[model samples]
Target: MIDDFLDGSLPAVEEAVRKAAAAEIMPRWRQLATHEIVEKSGPHDLVTVADRLAEAHLTVSLTALLPGSVVVGEESVHADPAVYAALRGDAPVWIVDPVDGTRQFVRGEPGFCTLVALAVRGEVLASWTFAPALDEMAVAVRGRGARLNGTAIRAGSPARGAVLKVAMSHPDYTTPEEKAALLCLDTEGVEARPCGSAGLEYLAVARGALDAVAFSWEYAWDHAAGLLLVEEAGGAHATLAGVPFRVTGANVLPFTAARDQATATRIRTLLTAP
Candidate 1:
């Protein structure tokens, strides 16, 4: 199954993501009525008809594409938290975040994206990030490297004595301590600010548009696709403990994904600095 997925099945998965976004996401982009959007946990935490319908669409299509494969979709897990356990299972699992930046989507912004990743036993093998509104698609296969709109790309090289441009998590979504740690990036020789859309942030790291991204949360649907993309693009992501970021939905907060391991270590050090 992995071989087939690498050889030809990937395009089908990519198409499924694109179709879901087109059918259930894009059409409702700026056209959603009041009733179609709802707050899941808070005003900032939103869910729309597009998010639910697209995850449903992806769940069916992706499972059909790989028989016996399980789906760990955001909405499904939200409904039944047990669905997320599939990431730890031996079966091939599809981790789907139908709309990664739902907040942006609800605001009729273009930063939203659909993220899907194929994983087995916590290892992501292939991933697709489709920013329909942005008309950008990023695909990565574990060993074959990554591509953005069909062109190969690599993460930016680490700065040599130059101020690093880092995107830290917004304070609104972080704990006080985490915010304080993130603020360390503001010290001399660094430019730091909050970032938009986890998916786009990772893509920026992969394409060399940004130096690195510091995230305070570790949700599989949010980071799985982006993690694979960055790694395949010759970047690295690690928890402050100095280990590879895991996708089993259980990880330390305040992780950094950088253009390279050296930069990642440096960012982690600065973030942990006293």
Candidate 2:
């Protein structure tokens, strides 16, 4: 299926994502009226008309490009949580987060992006992360490596013997144990701060801007594309339990992605340490 995707539908998928972003997302950036934005669960959790329209557009175009494929979009799942069940099904599934960082997007921030990943059962095979505001696009194929814009790039190595810089989940969103573990990064000679979008954090790790990212949530739409990007760029992501992350959303909390396996393991150890 991955081979088929790379050979036949990759371009179409990219086009669908770009089209949805340009048509529904970029146009509304920071231009949304008060009524167009609303809270999902709280003040921090947001949804916008752009997110809905983009997901709707991608769902139709993507499903058409791959006849039997199903879509598990963020907005769609918010409307019907059952839509996520497709990720566990036998068919190829398109996990879409039309506007990945809704809060950032609402604030006219550049960290928000459009995230799309193709997964079978529970494993992601290919992924795309498009930060329309930043005019950056990253693509990753299962074994073909990853690309930024159109050029191949490798994840940079961490500086030798320097304090690792990390972006961690905000304390407000983490459990008490998770928060304590996250603070351990500081004691371990790591610089830790709050992360914005999970997608952009992964991009930073892949590009070597930041040493690592520790995230508590495991939503497929948030982590799927970025996980592939990091892995293909010679980076690695794993749960604190020392296992690979699954897009099926059944992983332990506070997973870490870093420039390499060793850095990832080290960050994970710090975050999970007692």
Candidate 3:
């Protein structure tokens, strides 16, 4: 069933994402009221009416598109942590981050996007990343490659001897230990900056606009869509343990998604260095 959907209905899923963004997200951008936005964990972690409503809209539209599928959404998990268990269950799961950069959105910045990925038993099969404000939609299907705005894109390797451009987790979201691993990027041959919008950063890696991304956390909604996009675009991702990242959890911290396997290995080596 899942394969059948991926084989032919990708455009339908993309349209659903665009509709959710247009109906629930874009309307609230730069127009949010004081009462509509609130902190979830701290000042850095935010959730707004747009995020909630968009996720709700996608939940309904997506599940309806593929009957019997479940959703593991950021807002849904925030409301009920148990909902995340669907990722490991037998049902096909839609991992969604309706508003990937709430802070940027609230500030009227155009760096945010909506992310959705279809996964079954821990393997992501397809993904969509839509940046409505920027008028871009990136899609990826397992083994079929990735595309942006209907055109194929690739994550070409960085030039020889060029400094690797890496978008890393912000210090606020990292543990002291994870922070230490990320600090390793500060060495020569790498230019690292705090990430903005995990989805867009992953898109950057997929399209070769950016060299790589180093994230300390592993929320399925945040990484699922982007990781598959990078992979289908010929990029690679690795964790501190020198293995591919696993969306199902228990990955070593400060994982990297790079333009190619060699870059991924180099980043992994840096993360493991003393």
Highest TM-score: which candidate? 3
lDDT tens string, model 3, 69-169?
A: 99999999999999988889999999999999899999999999999999999999999999999999999999999999999999999999999999999
Query: TM-score of predicted model 3?
Result: 0.99
> Per-residue lDDT tens digits of candidate 2, residues 149-172?
988878878988988989888887
* C-alpha lDDT of residue 148 in model 2: 94
Per-residue accuracy of model 1 over 232-254 as CA lDDT, tens digit each: 99999988777888998566668
The stretch of ten residues in a row with the least summed lDDT in candidate 1 is 244-253
Ordered from best to worst lDDT, the candidate numbers read: 3, 1, 2
Question: How many backbone clashes can be found in candidate 1?
Answer: 0
**What do the candidate models score in CA lDDT, each in turn?**
0.90, 0.89, 0.94
Model 3: runs farther than 4 Å from truth?
none
Candidate 1's C-alpha runs over 4 A off are none
Clashing pairs in 2: none
Q: Any idea what lDDT model 2 has?
A: 0.89
Error of 1 at 109 (Å): 1.5
Error of 2 at 84 (Å): 1.3
TM-scores, each model vs. reference: 0.97, 0.97, 0.99
